[model samples]
Target: MLRFIKFAKDALLAFPLTLIFLPFSRFFSFLYYYNKLVIWIWKNKGDVTYHDFYSPFRDYKKRYALYENILQEQKLKEESICYLEFGVASGASFKWWLEHNTNIDSHFYGFDTFEGLPEKWGSFDKGAMSYKIPEIDDSRAKFFKGLFQETLNPFIQSHEVNITSSARRIFHMDADLYSATIFSLSQLFPYLKKGDLIMFDEFSVAMHEFKAFDEFVSNFYIKLRPIAAVNNFYQICFIVE
Candidate 1:
């Protein structure tokens, strides 16, 4: 008799909540299936392990080579360029770009919380990738220590003239959450132009990076063409068309 009463009480509590959320659940279910169909029809399926979009280099460093080739082909090496990186945990990738771009006129900016993610990301909690901001040691490379939404606008406004004058813009997105990626993309949409390269570090995670990119492009009516990608789909680079 006690077990039956407990079951009844639990069902009674859940009944109203389920009624309140039923519409939302149905709407999300429709969106999920719609997005799946769209991706299946539109997404490119290239060689997962290697692609020679620009260079023949087919190793772990292929992505870097592809970036270099894009820069060269676009003649951005001789012009001022803007390199923006989101989620600069240890500043490793930011430093690599600074060292490799080798253009005195190029400017690099990195944005991160430095304390890690603001919310949970799959197996990672709120503070999963926290790290101390490393000294970039380069005058052209600067770090903004805060969330992207907080720091991006001010930084962009301050450097609006320089950024607009730059011949090429590159964006590296390492933020591993859907919300972060989508928000950063939306914020940066106005500054993006043809020939700009956007590299996603965690692109393969279907529910996060991929979903964010899909929504961003769809909402903005932006055209993106895949230029390079890793075998496991962990990283992918797309050029704004």
Candidate 2:
């Protein structure tokens, strides 16, 4: 059976048809992961107890609600927490959390290229969505300006103890690229604790953030229990279990 399967595979690739299919390999691959994404959602949607799934429209405002819902559920609004936000374009979400938490001891770190995305995301070019980092008045908040691949490791090393400290950890993964999202998750997986929170700004996008998330959870065997999902799962929050 194995021999037959191998022979069939080799014959397909050795044929002229392979050239035609090769050009559309990415298209075919997307269908596979898109189907996987839909199936996974179908099977696990019931497990997400606090979701506003299947909304008729997408509203960016619902992200704040997602944040509030999780905070109210976890009772961490005023708690001392370590908040790390990846892809802090314009710093809107970063400022929102910083203002909402009101905990002086809660350290907020925002990571981004500030110049724009490190790679192209769908229609957006490599430098699309580029914005200068917003200036915030709080001393508790700091911005790391560079690629996650370059900056994250150094930050992790310096704050290794603080990362695993008593303060609650909340990671806002707003990076829309799979490469950025996956790299950030993989790097932070070892530091993730049971109570830590992980939110994806683009969880429903099949090819990028969703792909990274599916791979991260599956590959690491990390049980991330969905807590809140808004904007048709465009913004989903999970708690490490």
Candidate 3:
């Protein structure tokens, strides 16, 4: 009789709890389906899938291959190019560019906090990737220390004349956040020209770089064609049209 009474009491308590949560469950179900439809439409509207731009490669870094291919195809090394890199962690990629692009007149600029990310990212907390700004011995490369918002505008204003006159501009976006990526794009929008290339390091992160690029392009009515993409989609290169 005691066990039966306990069971009856538990059932009575669960009834009110279920009733209270039922509305939330239904609301979430609706939202889930709505988002699915939106994503479907988004995918159908020119977003390239892995199957659409995959090439067989063995034992090679696809991102570097794409960058080199684009550089060679555009003959950027033969022209006066202003290369800008966002999120210059440890200056490894920046140094690589300095060594490879042998053009005497080419200039490279790198932007970073040097204190690392301002906020938390996936599996990484704030201040992650922090490093001391390395001394780049090359005269062609310059590093700007601070947040992008703090550094980019002042630099752009100061060099507006030179920026306008540059023959070619290449943007290397290693920024891993949506805000940083989109902000950089907006700040540089006035300077972006046809035939320029923008390479994204974390393009496959849907909520960050990919979303930022999509919204920025749509907002600015900027047309872009995918020149190359890694098989895993971690990196992608696009030519602005």
Candidate 4:
């Protein structure tokens, strides 16, 4: 009886270990194949992101509301104010914003590599080189190609959207990478007005982004404040007024 009891205990302990090992092994295999799926999606659709990359239903609602509320609170009087988004994935957010806001006069611009992140990312992995997205046909919408440093300032200058010294009324940063997000914010931060809005889609996940913003605020003593926090694990919205 004693021997049987000892044997049973050992078997139970070993059972848990076996269970853990099997799931962990399966999990790694799943992760490997999942990454492959992402790469495949990017290859075929360089212009738009693959939906499987992120949860559309759960993650998108808060962001959409944030944009809508910002526009409402700012009370932007222009028939169409210039709005810019950095790192547009799949153009899904752009499509949602355009349709919901119905600011016929508002010109929405998105900037991306469309080919994915550049090589030699300073602190992060380069995103895939491309994605396929639907054609953004809203007269108020446009897409710019290349990196932020290469495309943003020049595009703003050409459009003559710079009022006084600032370039656009609203800007959304979703680059996800540290260098790209910081660079985009630095270049455009100067142009943000007292009533302008800027949203960061990766404020939490990307340590670099949070660190960069903290450093900038400390150095410049900027007064940007959070107006809406997406009650989630990631994403935050800020308003400068």
Best by lDDT: 2
Per-model C-alpha lDDT, please?
0.78, 0.91, 0.77, 0.64
Query: Model 2, 129-150: lDDT tens per residue?
Result: 8899888899999999999999
Residues 1-241 of candidate 4 have per-residue lDDT tens digits of 9999999889989776556577588567546544543453345333321122244445556666655565566565443566788888688777766775555667788899887777544454566636654497677888888888899888868875433334336677777776887788777666667867777775544244565565556666676766654534246666675
Off by over 4 Å in 3: 1-60
Stretches off by above 4 angstroms in model 2 are: 8-17
Q: Tens digits of per-residue lDDT for model 3 on 157-187?
A: 9878756775588899997987899999998
For candidate 3, the per-residue lDDT at 167 reads 58
Residue 235, model 3: Cα distance from true site in angstroms = 1.0
Query: Candidate 1: lDDT over CA atoms?
Result: 0.78
Q: Candidates sorted by TM-score, descending order?
A: 2, 1, 3, 4
Superior candidate under lDDT, 2 versus 4? 2
Candidate 3 colliding pairs, count: 0
- lDDT at 174, model 3: 93
TM-score versus the correct structure, for each prediction = 0.76, 0.95, 0.76, 0.65
Which of candidates 2 and 3 reaches a greater lDDT?
A: 2
Model 4, TM vs. native:
0.65
Best candidate according to TM-score: 2
